[model samples]
Target chain A: MTIAATKQFCTFFVGGHYFGVPVLDVQEAIRYQEMTSVPLSSSVVSGLINLRGQIVVAFDLRRRLELPPRSDGAKPMNVVVRHLDGVVSLLVDEIDDVVETDEVTFEPAPATLKGVAREVILGAYKLKNRLLLVLDIEKVLSIEAITSGDGDDNAS
Target chain B: MTLVGELVLARNQVLQFSATQSDPALLSATQQLNLLTSELQESVMKTRMQPIGKLWSKFPRVVRDLAGICGKRVRVQMEGEDTELDKTIIEAIGDPLTHIIRNAIDHGIEEPAIRTRRGKPEEGKLSLKAFHEGGQVNIEISDDGAGINVEKVRAKVLKQGLISPEQLTRMSERELIQLIFLPGFSTAEQVTSVSGRGVGMDVVKTNIEKIGGSLDIHSELGKGSTIKIKIPLTLAIIPALVVTSDSCRYAIPQVSLLELVRLDSEIAFKSVENIHGAPVYRLRGKLLPLVYLSSVLNTGSAQLNQDVASIDIVVLQADKLQFGLVVESIKDTAEIVVKPLGHHLKSASVFAGSTIMGDGKVALILDVVGLAEHAGLASKVEAIAASNLAGIQNDSTEGEKLLLVGVGDNSIAIHLSTVARLEEFPASAIESAGGRPVVQYRHGILPLVDLADFTGGYSAFSQNESPFQVVVCSGPHGIMGLIVDRIIDVVQENIQIQLIGERHGFIGSSIIHNKMTDLLDVHAVISSIDPSFFDEMKEALIGGVR
Candidate 1:
C-alpha cells in the first residue's frame, strides 16, 4: 500500500454548508470591515475592503453559490486568499479551524451536486462526522464567469 | 515598492492617531516617524528610475539598416542619453521612439542625389534629444531633410474627399500639415517597405498619448521637421483632488484640473441655466457645459435636489473638451499611490484604479476621458457647438466680420480687425491706479473702460464677485479693456447703417442676424474714457521712450 499523504485546508461556512480551500492558498481571515461599494459592478462583487491599506475586492460566497440570502444583522467574515493576479477576499458566514485529512479519504465530486456548486466544487473529503466540500479557488474566482452573469442582485 | 507604499499608508494612519493625543513623547515620535517614512519612500522611488540611454542603445543599428534600404545617407546623433526616467516609461517608449526614427529617415530625409541638388549636405542628420522641463520629460526627434509640403497635403486631402473645397480654403497652412496625423492619410507617391503603409503617424500619436504624453510637429517647406513629446515623470504616484458624491469619495487627477468655482445658492440659481436639457453655466463670457457626477455614476439621483445650499464645480479638461463636474462636496487634495483594480472590474470604464485613503479606506480614482465617454458628452457637445458656428458662417459672406457684444440690453458690433484679443479677469484682479481701474497684463498696465458706465446703461459694476468680460482693443495710446455684459455671435453681412439720433458711444445702427446692432466707434470710445490718454502716448512715442 502507498503511504497516505495528509493535506491541510482552511475551512469556512456559507449557507450552512462546510467548505474548505487549500491552506497554502489562504492569506488570512478577519472580522467584517467596512466596504466601499462599487456602483455598476457585477452582483457577486459585494464591495471593496481595506485590509491594512491594501484594496481587496470582496466577493460574496452566498450569492456566488446561488444559496438563500443570509439573515439580517448577521455580519459576514472575510476569507482573504491569493490569486494569480492579486489578492481577493471571499465573504462567508463563519470561519472554522484548519483541518488535516488523509489522502485516502478523498473522493471525486459526486454527480448529485447542482447549480454553481457543480462548477466550483472540485471533490470531497469524508470526515469523521460529515463531508467537507473542497472549493476550486481558480474556478470560483474566474474573471470570465464573474463578469458574464446576469447582474441583478444588489449587494449593497 | 508596494511594501513601501503600505508603510507610507501606515505612517499616515499613525500621524492621524497622534493628532488626538496630547502626550509630547508620542507626538514627537510620530513626527520623527513621518519624516523617516517620507524619506524612505523617496529613496525607494529613485531606485525604480533608469537612464533612458538604456532604451536608445539599439537605435543606431536601426537607423543604418533603414537608411540602406531607402538609398539615403543619414547619421544618428543623440543628446542627454543619461537623462533618467522611470523604468516603466523607458520600456513603454521604446517602440514609439523607434517608429518615429524610422519615419524620420524614410520620409523626412531626402535621398543623397536630391540633397546634393538642393545645396544641402549629402548626409542627412537625425538628432534625438531628451531633457527635463516643467517637472516632466521632453524628447525631440528632428531631421534636416525635405519638410512636409503643405500644398501636396492639401491636394491629397481634397483628393481623398476629407473636406470640402470651401473648408479647405479656410484651413491654415499649419492645419493642413497636421492632416498627416489623420488615420489612413499619406502624402507619399508610392508605398514603401520602410514606411508609408498608411498606418504610421496616427498610431504613433495614439501610443504616445496613451501614456499621458503629447506630440506636436513643426516643419518648414525645405528645412526639415521636429516632433516634440512631453510626458509626466512617473505614473506610480500623482496628486489628486478628492470630492464626495452620494457620500462616496472619488479622486480626480490634478493633471486634468483647471480651476475650482464655488457658487452660493443665490448666484447658482441665477447663473446656471438649462439649454434643451443640458445645464450650462456662464463662466466669464463663454458657456461651460456642466456634468453631474451623481447621475453619471448611477450612485443616486442626487442631481435633482434643488435645495442644495451651495454648488461646487470642479473644472476638468479631458482631451480637447473642457467641462465642469459638479460634486456634492470638496475635500482636501492628497498625493495618492495608484493601484490597479482586479481583472474582474477592469471593464468598468469610469474608474481608473483604486487607492487607499489616509483613513485606511479604499477610494476609487476616476478616469476623466472614460467618464466623459460614459456620460456621452464629448461628441454631443462638440457636434452642437460645431453646428451652431457652421449655421452662422453659412448665412452670409459679403461684409466685414464683426464681434457682437451685449451691453445691458443693447447689441453692439466692433470691427474684428481692430480687436486685439478677448480676455476675462476676476473682479478681485482689478486694482485702482491713479483713480482708474487697471490690471497688470503682459508686464504692462491695461486700463479698464466700463462700457455700461460709459453708455449710461444699467451699471452692474458694483458686484465685486462676478468676473469682467473684457474685449481688448489696441488704441493709439495703449491697450484698453472694454467691459461688457456678455458676448453674442459674430456675423458677416453687408452693413446698411440706419442713422439714428446721435447716441453716446454709438456711431450708427444696423440690422444684422435679425437684431438691431450698433456699430461702436472704438477710437471715440477710448478717447472719451480719458481725453489725455492718447496725448501722453504720442508724447512718449515722439520722445523715443516707447
Candidate 2:
C-alpha cells in the first residue's frame, strides 16, 4: 500500500479541546495585548488589538465555540491568522505545538457533532496522545457565521 | 507601502523609548533616526505619486467619441497635465472624471449648428484643468456649451414632487442649479444611451466625498457649467481630532469638524435646554442640536456627566446638517493613519475604522455621518429642515421666518420679523400690575403675556423654578414679552393658513413642519390682556399730532 501525504497544522487549546489550523494560515501567536473594546459589536468580537502597528480585531474563541467564560484574571493568548479581509487574532486559552498527521488516520467530522462546532470543524486526526480537531479556518473566521444564531449568547 | 508604514511606526516607538534616556549619544542617534525615517517615508510616498495627466491622457478620445455620438463639434483642451496626485486617487477619480466628460458632451454642449447660430465658434470648448492649492488637488472640468437651465431643473423638481412650488420659489438660482446633483435627478429631457439615466452625478458626488473630497458646480444660463472637485492629497493619512467618551478615546476626522465649543458649568446649564427630550444649545442665536457620544454608543457608562460641571462640544457638520457632539474631554489633534476594521465589527456603522495612537493603543474613529444616523438625529434634522434647501436664502421677504415655540403640548409660530430679541427672564423677577403679569426690563416695565393662558395649556414657568422663555417683541405700545414653555427652532416657511382662527388669540392654524402649528396673533393677545395697551399708543400719537 502507498503511504498517505502528511499535513502540518498550528495547534491551540480552548475549553479543553485541541484544535489545529493549517500552518500556512497562522501568521503568529503572541501574548495578550491591551484591547480597545468595541461597544456595539458582536459578542464573539473580543475587541481591537494593536498588532505591531496594524489594528486587528480579536475574537474570543471560547464564546465563539459556545464554551463557558474563562477564569478570572486568566488572559488569553492571541493566535493571529491571515484572513481574506485582513488579519484577525483568535483569543485562545493556550498555544500548543504544531502537529503533523497523514490522511490514513483522518476522519471527517462526525455527523452527530451539532451546532457551531459542526460547521467550523472539518475533521479529526487520531493522534497517539489524543484526537486533534482540524479547524476550517475560513469558516471559523467568516463574519456571517460569527454573527448569526447562537453568536450573541455570551456577548454580554 | 505597508512595510514603510510599519517602519514609520517602529521609528516612532524607538523615539518614544529614547525620550527618557539621558545619554547624549543615544539621544542624538534617535533624533537622526527620526529625521531619516521621515525623509525616507516622504521618498516612498513620492514613488507612488503619478502625474494626473496619466489618467487624463485618454480623455481626448473619450471626448471625441462622445461628441460624435451626440452629433456635437467639441474641442478638448488640457492644462497642468504635469500636476501630480497619489496613484490611488488618480485611479479613483478616473471613472467620475470620465462620466463628467461624457455629461458635458451629451448635455452641456450645444450642437455645431446651434453654436453657429449663437454667433460663437462652430465647436464647443471642453477644458480640463488640474492644480494644487491649500494642500489639496483641485480639478476643474469646464465646457463652453449650453449651460444648465435653472428653470428646467426647477420644473423637473416640481414635477417629481421633490419640492413644493412655494419651497421652489424660495430656492435661489444657484441652489436650483445644484439640484442636478440630487440622486435620481436628470435634466436630459430625453434619456439617451450615454449619460442621462439620473445615476451619474449623485454617484460622482458620493465617490468624491468618500475620499475626503468636495464637489461644486457653477453654471450660467447660456454660458456653460464648471464642475470643480477638491480632493485630499492622499487617503491613507488624515488629520483627526481626538476626543474621549466613557473613558475611551475616539478620533473624528477634521474635515467634518467645524469648530470646538467649551461651555463652563454655569453657561452649560443655562444654554443647553431640552426640547421634546432632545437637548439643544443656543449657539450664537441658532439652535444647535446636541448628541451625547456615550449615550449613542451605549457604552454602559453613567449617562453624560449628569451634573455636567463643564462640557465640551465638538461641532461637526454631517451631510450639511450641523450638530454638537457632547464628549467627556477634547484631546489634542493628530494626523492618524486610517486602518480598516475587521469584518466582525464592520456592521458597527458608528465607527468608520480604527487607528493606532502614538502610545500603541487602538482607538476607534468616529464616522460623523454614521454617528448622526445612529443617534437618529439625521432623520430628525432632515424632517425639521425639510425646507433646508432654502437655508441659503437670506432674503426674508421671500418667505415668512417664524420662531417655533412649544406651549405645553402645542406648537405655536410667531413671526420672526416682529421679534426684537429672545430673552430669558427669571420667574422670581415676575411682578403683578393691575391683574396682569409684568417684569422690570431695560429701565422700564415690560408687560408679559402668558401664552399658556391664551392657548388654555399648562404653564411651564408655574410648575418649575426655571426661567421664563420670553420672546421679546416691539408693538406700538413698546416691547412686550411673550412667555413660552420652550423655544423650539427658527424656520423660514411659507405660511399657508389652512384653518381660520378658532380661538381668541390664534390668527389661524397651518401645517408647519408637518405639524398643526397655530399662528399667534401678537396684537390680539396683547389686547386681550390689556385693552388699553394699544389705546395708550394711539392717545400718545394723537397728542403729538395736536
Candidate 3:
C-alpha cells in the first residue's frame, strides 16, 4: 500500500502547442536551414541559427509562449537544445516524436495561470482525452523573457 | 663643451704622441690631433645627424652672450642641423628652438638705431630650417625685425575674446598671424623677461605639440616671425587598416586612409540611408554620416540577415573630419609595429597602440580621434546632433516614393542606394514601411528603417560580413544602401564570431564554415536611423540627385 501517484506527461506542438518539453530537454533535432538575424537584437530574439556549425539562437518559442501565431508557413524547424554555455534553437511548430511516461501525468495548474502564457506552462497532461500542457523550456528560454515589454514596440 | 673637451684633448693628443721625437713642432701638434680623431669616427658612420647643431650651437653662444647683455646685436642663422630627429626629437627642439631665438633677439631685433628706421639692417636675420615634409618632420624658425603688430594683432584679436571685431575684420593676414597662438597670449607692449609672462606663443604651441608636433606662426607687419614645426614620422612605425568591429579587430591608420568601399550584396542595401534613424551616405555628392565600430564597444551579432548583402566602407581622413568606418572586411595594410597601451591603457581614449598583426594577432590601434571623441562624434554640430538622433530628414520619406526592401526566409528584395538603375519591385508588389497590415507586404512605399536601429544599433552591426535591415538603409547615418534579401554568394568568405548569447548587441556569433552567422548591430542600426536626421535641410536630399 505505498502510493503517492501524480506524474505522467509527453505533449508537443510548440507555438500553438499541445506543449510539454522535457523528454530530457531534447539535445538533438534539426530542420531550419539558414537563420541569421540578430542585429541590435532583443525583440524576442528570433535570430542567430546554424546548429551544425554551432552559433544557435533562433528563439521565437511562439514569441516565448504568448502562444498563438505559429505556422507562418512551416519550413523552419531547428529545435536543437542545451543553452547557456551554448546550443539554443527553439523556433518549432513541427518536431513531434518523443513520449515516455511520468508522475501520474500532471494536472495542477488551472487558476488562469497568471498570464504571458503563464510564464510558459508547468503542469497539464490529460492525454487520451487530450489536454497535454507542461512545457517550461528553461523558463521559456529566459533572458528576463526576451528583453521584456521591449520598452515598447508591439505596434505592428 | 668642445666635444667633451675634444675627447679628452683628442686623448691627450694621442698620449702626447710618443714617437719619442725631439720636438718636431711638438710632433706637428700631435699629428693634427690624429686627423681630428678620424673625422670624429667617420662622423659616427655618416648621416642622421642630431645634437641639433649641438642644440643650436648653444644658441650662438647665447647670442654672443646676449649681445653683451642686451646692448643688442643678435645675428643667429642655423638651418635644421642635418634634421635627424628622435633623441626625443633633439630633446624636443631644444627649448622651443631656444625660446624662439630669445624672442627674436629680445623683442625682434630693433636697436642699431631702431634698425635704421625699420627698413631693417643692423644685424637682424635670425634663422633655423629642419626639413622632411608631408609625412611630418618640419621645423622652420625665422626673424628679421619688428613684426608683431596688426594694431597689436587687432588689439590682441580683440582683447582675447579671441575674435569679433567682426572676427578681427574677417582675419587672414594668415588668420592674422594665428592670433599669436592663443593660450594666455601676448601682443607684448610690455611685460618682458625676453617675453611676456603670458608664456609666449602658447608655450611655443605647447612644446611643439609635446612631440607629436604642429605649430604655425607667420607674421609680416614690419616683416619677421615664421615658426613652423610638424613632427610624426615614426614614434614606432604605424600605417594600419585591419578592421573587424564587434568580434573586435581594429587598426585603421594609413595616416587616416581615404578609401575602401566594397558594399556587395548588391551594394549593402543600396548603400544605406535612413535619415529618420540616421545613417546617411550619398557620398560623392555629399551626405556621408555613419559610424559603427560597434558603437564604441556595446558588441553584438549572431546573425542579422546574413550581413544584409556585402559591406566594408572604411573611408576615414581625420583633420577636417570625414567619417565612414562601417567595416567587416578590408583587412591588410599593416606596417604595424607600435606598442604602447600600458599605463592602464593611457586613459582608454579609444586606444592608439598594440599592433603586432601579420597573423601574430594583437591588433588594437584605432583612436580615430579617440573614436570621434567617444562617439558623440564631435562636430558638424556634433554631426547635426548625431544626425538629429538618427532620424535624419531632408524630406524624402515624407515626399514618399521610397523603396529599399530585403527580407529573406521566404525572401524579399529591392535596393538602390541611388541607382537610376536596378528597378524591379514585384515580389508581387510589396508594402510595409507604412501600409503595415501585419506585413504579408506589398503595393508601394518600399523603403524601410529597422537596419537594427540604423547604423548605431543592432549592437553596432558587428561586421565581418556585416549586414542588417528591417528596412531599406541607405548609408552614412541617412540613406546609403542596405536592401538585402540574399546575395549571400560572394565567395571570399572567411570569418569566425560565435561567442554565443549576451554579447549579441555588437559581436558574438559569426562562424562561417562550421556555420554560425549573426553579427549585425552596426552601431545599433546607425543609431536607429535618425531622430531628425541632421536637420538643416529644407534642401539636401535632391543633392544625392533626384
Candidate 4:
C-alpha cells in the first residue's frame, strides 16, 4: 500500500479567497494595531506596525494580490511570517484555522488563474469546504513588482 | 566550575522547573539562579578582555626607529599599560595609535639642537598613556616638544583659500588648531616621507570613529601637543534611546544623542520659528537647525501645527553640528542589539540598520551621519551657522554695535564691522551698467545691490524724489553698495538674535530699543549680487595673509 505524508498549512482569508502558507514559515498571528505609514515607500506597503517592541513592515495582501479591499470596518488580522529577507507581517481580512492535508491532494494552479496572485501560488490543496491556494511566501514578499515600478496588479 | 558550564546548568534548571507547576519556594529558588546567571555573564565577558599593554608592547621599538629617522633625540614613557580593553578595540586602535606616535616624533618634537637652544632637555619626552574613563578607554599621546606652530597651520589654510578671511577673524585659536585634521590639510612645508604624504589626521579620525571612538587634539604653543582618543567597550551592543516619530519607533544611538527638550504648544511656536520654510529652534541663545522626523521619512505630513498641545524634540550631534529633531514622543531607553537591514532596503539612507526590541518588534536605527547629510546639515552649512551664531551673541565689552538701515517697510541692523562707508545718491546718479546698477564712488565703479529686492522686499526704486542711502559693504569680494530706503543710525544694544529668517541677505531678527529689527547677512548679500565676487577677493586676501 502507498502512503502520503500529511502537511500542515496555516491559512488566512483575504479579498474573498482563502490563502495558505506552510506552517513552518508562519511565525504567529496577531491583531492589527497602530501602524506608522512610511511616506515615499512602495504603494503596497501598508505601513510599519510595532509588534510588541519590534517594528514589523506590514504588507497589504489585498493590494499585493490585486484583489478588492475589505468593505467591512473591522481591523484585518496580521499573519506574521518569515522569509529569507526578514520577518514580515501579512495583512489579511481574517485568520483561519490551521489545516492538515495529504500531499497527494496538492494540485498545480489552474490555467484560468492569472497575474501576480497566480504567479505567487505554488499549488492548491483540495479541502473539504474549499480549495486552499498555497502561497510561495518568498515570491509573495519579493517586492520586485512594487520596487521595479511596473505598477502591474492582478485584479485590476 | 566554568562560567559557561554554570550558565548552561542554570538555564536548563530554569527551563525544567518552568514546565511544572511553580511553587513559591521554587520561584524563589529560580530568582537565586538569575543572580548567579548575571554573575556568570560578567565572568564570561572578562574572557574577551586583555591588558592594553599587549597593544603597547611594540610602541617602544617603533618610536625609537622613527625618532632616529627624524634626527630627533626622544625619550619614551608609558603609564597605565595594564588598563584592560576589548580585544577588538585593541586590534583596531593599533595602527591609528602608531600613526599618532610617528606624527608626534616627526612633527611635534624638535631636533636635539633646537630643543637644547630652547633651554629644555636635549631629548624630547613623548608619553603614551592608557586609562579607563566613564566606561570608555582613553589613550593619550603627548609630546613635550615645540607645540604645533599655529602660524604655519594658519598660513597653509589661507593659501588653500578653503576658508574666508571673515570666518578666520572670528575663529578661536582652538578652532584654528582643529583644521589640521581636515583631509589634504598638511601644515608641513616639506613633504616628509615619514608623516607627510598629505594623508594624515583625517584618516586617523575616520578609523577611530569607525569603532565608535572620538579623537581630540589639544595644543599650546611652546608647551606641547596632546591627542586623546576615547573608545567605547564594544560595538556589538549599544545603549540607545527609543523615540517615536510619526508613530513609528526608531532608535537613536546614545553616543550621538545630546539631550531632549519638550515644549508646550504655545511656547513651542514662539521658541521655534520658520525661516524660508526651514524650521529653527532658539536653544540656549544659539540658533539650532531643526528637522522633522515625519518630513524626512515621507510619512504623515510634517506640519508643525500651531494648535498642537505639545511637541518632543531630541537634540542630537551629527559630526560637529548639533540639530534638534522633532518627534511625536520620547520612549524608554534600552540596550538594543543592532541588526543590519535586508539587502533590498540597504539603499535607504535614513536608516543605519534595524534592531529587534525587547518585545521582538523591529526598530530601525537611524544613521546619524546619513540623516545629517540628507537634511543638508553639512560642515559648510554648520560653519556658516556658527559664524552667524557668533555674530548674534555680540556681547563684547565694546557693546553690540550694529548699523541700522531701512529696507522696503522694515528696518534692519547690519554688523558695523561689515560696513566700510556710507554714501548717498540721487536717482539720476545711479546708472545701469553691465545689467547692474552702479554708482561712481571714491575712484571706481561700485556695484549697487538692492537690499529690498535681495531680501524679497519690493523694489525700493520708484518715483521718489528722496535720495537713496547706500551702505558700502566690503567682503572677500570687491566693495559693493547696498542701496537702502534710509540710513537710520549706528547703535549699540544688548540685543540677541531671537528670530532667524531665511532670506538672501537677512541673518535673523533681534529686538533693538524694544523694536524687532531684522539682521542682514552682508557677505551673502554681496555674493548674491556677484557670485564670483569672492573669487577675485580670495587672491587679494591670500596675498595679504601670506
Candidate 5:
C-alpha cells in the first residue's frame, strides 16, 4: 500500500501556545479590524467584524481556551474559516507559518490538557521544537454548549 | 423584480459611471441610465404591490363560515379594498385577519337576542374596511357586537394572577380591555372551539409584529370593537441611519430612529446625570433615558470625551418608549438591505441583523427593540415626563395632589394620580419568583419592587413576620409596590420640586411643611424592576386604546 506524503495545517498562536487547524478548513487570515460587539452573547464571542461586506462572528481563542488575556493588550489577527452557512473569524495572538507533517505523527489529546483547551483540542502533532495542538474548529466554535449551559451529553 | 436585483444593477451603474466620469458623453449617458434605472426600479416596486382587494377576496368566505360556526346573523361589509400593499404583506396578513374576524364573530357581535335587546338590528354588521393611511395599509375589522367587557377581562386577569387588583383599579378602560391579548388569558369562560381556546390574541399580535406591522384594538362597551392592523407597504428595503460606536459601524432602522440630538459638552455635562448608575439626559424639558452603545455590547468605551465640545445622541423610539442612544457619531442615512444573522448568532438580541453598507463593510443593524430591552431602557419614562411637563405647564398655579409615603428615614411624595393604592402584605408572603419579589394581593400576583432598595433607602421590616407596608403605584409596567415603612397622609401641595442629588427613584426634592420630601419617579422605579415589564403594556395600550 502507498502511504500519503503529508497533511498541511495552519498554525496560530494563543496565550504562548501554538495551535493548528487543518489547512483545508482555513479560508484566509487578515489583520484585526474593528468589530461591533453583540450584547448578551456568549463570553467567547469577541464581537462581529465586517469582512468585505460579509458580517463574520469573531470568536476569541484565548477566551474559548480559558487562557489568560494577552498581557500587551494588542489587537489579534483574524483567521477566517468557513463555519456552517457563513464564515467565523478566529481571533489569535499571532499567525504562524503553516506546517506540513505526516498524519502518523498526530496523537490523541493528552489527559494533561487542562480546562477549555482540553474540551476543544482534537489532537496534537509533535514538532521538532514544540507540540502543535490540533484544534477542531467546529468544537471550538460551538457556542451552544456554553450559552445553553448544557453538559456535553447531546451535542450534534 | 426583486429589490436586491435592482440594487445590484444600480450599484453597477454607479460604479461604472464613477470609473469613467472623465468622459463627458459617458457622464451624460450614465446620468440618463441612472434616471431610467431609478424609474425602472419604481415600476418594478409597483409590480410587487397588489391591491388590498386580493387580501379581502377571501374575507367574505371567512366571515360566512365564521357566522355559520357561531350561529350568528352577520353581514361582511368591505370598503377601500382597492388600496394596495406589498404582495408579501397581503399574503402574511391572511391568518391574522382570519383570527380577528373569528374573534369578531364569536365575541364581538353579540347573539341575535342580545343585539335586539340592546336596541340594535338583529342582523349584526361586521365591516372589513381597508384604507391607505400615513404611508401604511390600514385594515379595520369592526363588528357591531357587545364590545369587549373590560370588567370581565379585569376579573379574568385577576383570577389568573397576571396582575393585582390595585393594577386593575389603575388600568384605564382601554387598558383593561387590552388584557384580553395576554397569553393564556381568555375572558371566554367556556372553552370555545371557535375563538377562545386559550390560544389567544398574542399569537395574532406576534404574527402582526413579525411582519413589521402593529395591531390596535379599540372597543366601546355595548357598541362594538374595531381591531386595526397597520402594515408598511414593503419590508424588502428600509431607510436606516448609520451610526458608529467604539469604531464599529451599525445601522439603526429609520422606522425606530425618531431624531438625532447633538449636545455641546457643557450642555451634556449639565443635562446628563447618572441616576443609580443608569445615565439619563435631560432633553428640552423632560428626562430622556440614555444607553451607551459601548456599555451594552461590552465593547470599548464610546470614549466620549467629557471635555469635547459636542456629543451626538440618536433618539430611538422602540414601541412606545423613546430613549437616546449615545454613539460616537452619526453617519449618512441610506436605504439598506437587511440580512438575517446566521443561526449561530441568532441569540444575540442586540443585533436585528446585519446590513452591508455602501462601502461594502458589514454593518450590524441595531435592533432598536432589542437594544432597548438589553440596556433595560424599555420604560414608560417618556410618558411620565410628558405628563409631568403638561402638569408643570398647566397646573403650575394649581395645587397638585400627592401621595405621601414613609420610607426608612425619609418621606417621599409621588403623584397622587400615579398611585394606585396603599396596601400591606405579610413579609412572608413576599416570595421570590422569577428572580423578583412577588406578593399575592386580592387574588392577583403583584410584583413588589422596592424603590428603597434601588435608592439606598432602608426597609424597616426585615423579618417576614412583620406586615410590609406597600405603596402600590401604577406605571406603564403594570403595578409594583414601593415597599415603605408606612403610608403617610395624602397631601395637596403646590411646593416647587427642587433638584437634589441624583437618585434612582427620586425625581427631586421639595419642601413640604417643615421637612424635605423626595419626589418619586414612579415610572423609573417600576422600570428598574423589569425593563420588559412595560414593553407588552405599551403594545396592549396601543392595541386597545388607539
Candidate 6:
C-alpha cells in the first residue's frame, strides 16, 4: 500500500517569540470581526463571532499563556480551528505560513510542567534560530481547565 | 414613629458631623453620626432597586452561546426593560430565563445561512418582553426563528423511549412538547453548554411552579416560538380555600376548583349508585366517579351522614380530569401566606406546602393533580371522557333496556337488566317504579305492539316499593333505578335498531306506553349509566338480542 505522509508545520514568531499550532487543526487565518462577550464563561474564553454562517467561539491565547492582559483596544487577528466538539477561532497577535520540518526531529519534555500553563505546551520544537514552543491549541482553550478552582475568579 | 426615626437619624447625623468637623486623628479614631438626609438618600439611591431588566442585559450572552452551537446569527431585542421584581425572585428567574433564551437561539432560531437560503432576512430577531398584568408579571421570550419541529419532538419522544409508538399516535402536538419535561428526555446527540443536558424544561417548570407561577408555550413550524410565564407579584399572599376532609384541614386553591355541591342523603340515595362497588353519581346525565377524600388519605370515610346527611362534592378541573371530590364542607376562602414544608414533610406530595389559616390552624395546601397522579387514575378520567363521547356517537345503539312498565294509570320507565323476568300477574304482579302512581294494566311500552296507551282513564293509587312499574334494579353498568308500573315480559333487540323517532315504544312494535318514548339508544344508555358496564364499551350497540 502506498503511504501518505503528513505535512510538516512551519514555525513562526509574534512579538519576538516562537510558537506553532498544528496546521491540520487550523482551518484558515483571518483578521478579527466584532467579537461578542460570553459573560458566564472563563476570562480566557473571550466570546463568539458569526463567521460566514458559522458561529465560532474565540478564545484569547495570550490570557491562557498568563502573559500580561491585552488592553481592550488591541486590534487582533484570529486563527480559526476546529476544536471542543465545535469550531473555535483563537484571538492571537499574528499567524505565519507553513515551514517544513522533519517528523524524526521531535523531542520529549525535559521535566515537570506541573503548573497552570503546563498543558498548554506540547513537547517543544527546536529550530535553528531558537526554540519554537509547540502550542496545544486544544488544551490551552479547554473550557474545563480554563475555568478550574485554581483561577482567581470562578468562571460560572 | 417620628421620635424613633429622629433618634436614629439624629445619632447618625451627630456621628457624621463629628467625623467631618474634628481633627483628622479623632476622625480616624472614632466619629459620631452625621447623617444628611441627602447622604442617606444618596446611599439608598446607590442601592435604589432598579428594574429587573438590569439582569436582562445578559441575553446577548445567551444568543452568543446558542449561536455557537447552532451556527446561527441571533440578535436579541428586549422590551419592558424597566419591569421590576423582588431582588430574590430576580436572582431565581435569571438563570432559568437564560436557559430559555439559549434554547430559543439554538433550537428555535434556524441557522443563519439556512435563513438566507429560505429567502428570509439573514439576521434572526429574538424578543424578550416582560410586562406586569393582574397581580402577576408576565414574561415572554419569543424568537423569529424556526419554531419547534413537532415531528422532531414526536420522533425524539419515541426514540428516547419516553413514550411508545402507539402512544405517540394518539398524543396531540401539544402533548409531544410536554415530553420535554419528562425529567431526562432529550434528543441531542452531543451535550453542549447550550441546552440538551435533559433537565432544561423540567427545571424551568419546577422553579416557576415553586414560585406559584406557570408557563405556557406556543410555537408553529417555520415561524418562531413563544414561552409566556405567569408569576405572582409577590410571594406574600395567595387565594386559598380552607376545607376539611377526614378531619384533616387542607387548603384547596380557589382557582382550580369548579364548584362545591351539597348532596343530601335523601337526594344522594336517589342519584348516587354503586357500580362494581365504586360510588358514582349521575351528574348531568353522565356518571361522574366520586372520589371520597377520606378513602384517598387512607383514613376511612368521613361521617357525611350527619343531620341532613349532607356530603360536599368539591368539583375540580386538573389538566383534563373533571372530578368531584367528596368532602365535609367548605369553611371559607382566605388569602393565606404559605411556608415551605420542612424536610420531613416534603415527601408528602399531596400537600404542595403548608399554610396557617386565619384561625391559626395549620392546613396543608392540596395539590389536586398530585393526588390523582399518586392514585394512577389520570387515564381513568380519559376513559370516562372517551366513553361519554362514544356515548353520543352511538346513541340509538346504546344496548340497554329503557323499559316501559304499567303504573296505576300510566306507564313508567325502568332498566331492563333490573327486571329478571315478567309474567302474567293476573293484575296481582303489580309494583311501583318507586312509590309513584300510574296505570295498573300490566302492558306498557311493551304493549305498544298491542297499542296499550289508550286505557289511560283508569283510577290511580300507590303501592309502596312494589308498584306496577318496570323493575329497574340498577344494572352494573347500565340502568340503575326501576321506573316500573308493572312487570312485562323481557324481549331483547339489537339496540342499534332504534324505534322510529316518533312516539314509539319498541322498534317496529306499535306498543305505545302512556308517555312519549324514543327507542333506547341502547349503547348510550349502557355507557351513560355506567362506563364500566360495556364489554369493550364500543361493543355496546352490537349486543342486541342475537
Per-model TM-score on C-alpha atoms: 0.69, 0.65, 0.23, 0.50, 0.61, 0.45
lDDT of 4 by residue, A51-128 (tens): 644457788888888887778786888999986756888999999989998888899998888888678998899988
Cα deviation of B198 in candidate 4 (Å)? 5.6
List the DockQ of the predictions in order: 0.59, 0.46, 0.01, 0.14, 0.15, 0.01
Per-residue C-alpha lDDT of model 1 across residues B137-192, encoded as one tens digit per residue = 89999999898889999998889887799988977677687788888888888888
Candidate 4, residue B171: the lDDT equals 67
Question: Candidate 4 vs candidate 6: which has greater DockQ?
Answer: 4
**Tens digit of lDDT per residue, candidate 2, span B1-546?**
666666666776677688788999999999999899789878977998999989999999989898888898899999999988988889899999999999999999999898889987989999999999856889999999889998889988888887789988977787787788789888888888996688979999878866767788999877999999988787776778999987889999887789999999877878887665678887755668899888887764534555777999999987557999999999978667778777777677788788887778889999887888789895456443444345533333357889999999999999888889899988899987555678878876678888999889888777678787999987766788999999998887677986663898888999877898999988787666566754554554477579
- Per-residue lDDT tens digits for candidate 4, residues B133-176, read 76678899999988888778888888878678787766678778
Tell me the deviation in Å of residue A33 in model 6.
70
Ranked by DockQ, the better of candidates 1 and 3 is 1
Which lDDT value does model 4 have at B59? 88
Query: What is the RMSD, in Å, between candidate 2 and the native fold over all Cα?
Result: 13.1
How well is each residue in B315-428 modelled by candidate 3, as lDDT tens digits?
Answer: 775545677767666666644545544322334555665544433334566767666656655434244545656763333312212132223331111222222322323333
Rank by TM-score (best first): 1, 2, 5, 4, 6, 3
Off by over 4 Å in 2: A1-3, A128-130, A147-156, B1-4, B14-54, B75-84, B103-134, B138-228, B301-303, B343-349, B386-546
Model 3 residue B504 lDDT score: 28
Q: What tier of docking accuracy does candidate 6 attain? A: incorrect
Top TM-score model: 1
Task: Arrange candidates by DockQ, descending.
Answer: 1, 2, 5, 4, 6, 3
Give candidates' CA RMSD values in order: 8.9, 13.1, 37.0, 20.1, 19.9, 25.4
Better of 2 and 4 by TM-score: 2
Highest DockQ: which candidate?
1
Better structure of 1 and 6 per DockQ: 1
Native contacts kept, each candidate: 0.70, 0.84, 0.00, 0.27, 0.32, 0.00
Q: What is the lDDT of every predicted structure here?
A: 0.84, 0.84, 0.56, 0.77, 0.77, 0.60
Question: DockQ of candidate 4?
Answer: 0.14
Q: Per-residue lDDT tens digits of candidate 6, residues B97-155?
A: 88788778767787778888877799898998989876568899999888878888888
